[model samples]
Target: MTVDKESDKGPYICNGTQSSDPEYTQSSDEVTLTVAEKPEPELTSDLKGAALTGNSVTLYCTLKLQSAGWKFYWSKDTQSRETETETNHYFIRSVSVSDEGQYRCRAGRGNPVYYTHYSDALWVTVSGESPPVSLIINPSRSQHFTADSLSLSCEEQRDSTGWTVKRYTL
Candidate 1:
């Protein structure tokens, strides 16, 4: 049997002797299969809000891809990235005042990957520490009052003029 090689198609046999078998006379067709690369995961979360100084806050990021399985990574602003290969959730154990900043995440299956970042900065503010100031009231010893009332004001020492005092009667 003589084989014929064609550039457009593939190898074929042009047997010198005509074959009585139909299989030998027929040519086999070839099909090409292609698999697309999966897209990178997307990071989704709300990082902007007011949080207490020592309170724990959770920042979330999600990866949406064509494939079911993937790895997730979390990174603080300008810091080294942390990878969570097994799970989708990223947890911040104790969110501190300094820990407040922009955060991002990346997701991919393997190398040659897709990475989606958070579009806007997750702005977080740490509740201020300065405690509210207390006011002192002193009655004049020289003055004796009968059936009289006194007015005292409680003002914040930081910005005394800016404070609005509210009185509560018990």
Candidate 2:
């Protein structure tokens, strides 16, 4: 490495050329660059939908590898990336069928950035009827103690043909 001064007006300039990096052999002055493979982000969601209309869903993107400082970009159904988030979580406030699509994400960091490959696609679907639905849980609530056994049913106000009572505990 060498430092040169053209004049006193210049702040010190690094006139250094060449690198000690063992990754490449600079042949005939044509510098070839190699990029590492992109990491795949893991996608997870709160509800594995067919979720109800008014509920919100948050999708989380995680890197399986031990790397840091990543910004995420998300894509749905197409290759075009949308929604650049510094954090790994993508939040959808209220979902409709229009929001139903396959989603993927990638992670990138650094100035001349290296990006991980797109993650495995996650599918989200929204289900609703023409008149919509209002669900009621039986035995009107006030606050109850934990571990008390409660048998609740999601009584849909309008539809009976395609209704099921399902409960999930986390």
Clashes of each: 0, 3
The estimated TM-scores of all candidates read 0.44, 0.55
lDDT of each: 0.56, 0.72
For model 1, residues 50-164, the per-residue Cα lDDT tens digits are 7655555665555444356566677678577565655666665555778777766666555775455533445556674433556544453456488766655665756645445
Model 1 lDDT-worst window of ten: 1-10
Q: Which stretches of candidate 2 lie over 4 Å from their true place?
A: 1-37, 129-170
TM-score between candidate 1 and the true structure: 0.44
Write the residue-wise lDDT of candidate 2 on 67-113 in tens digits.
67889889899757578998999988887778888988888899898
**Poorest 10 consecutive residues by lDDT, candidate 2:** 1-10
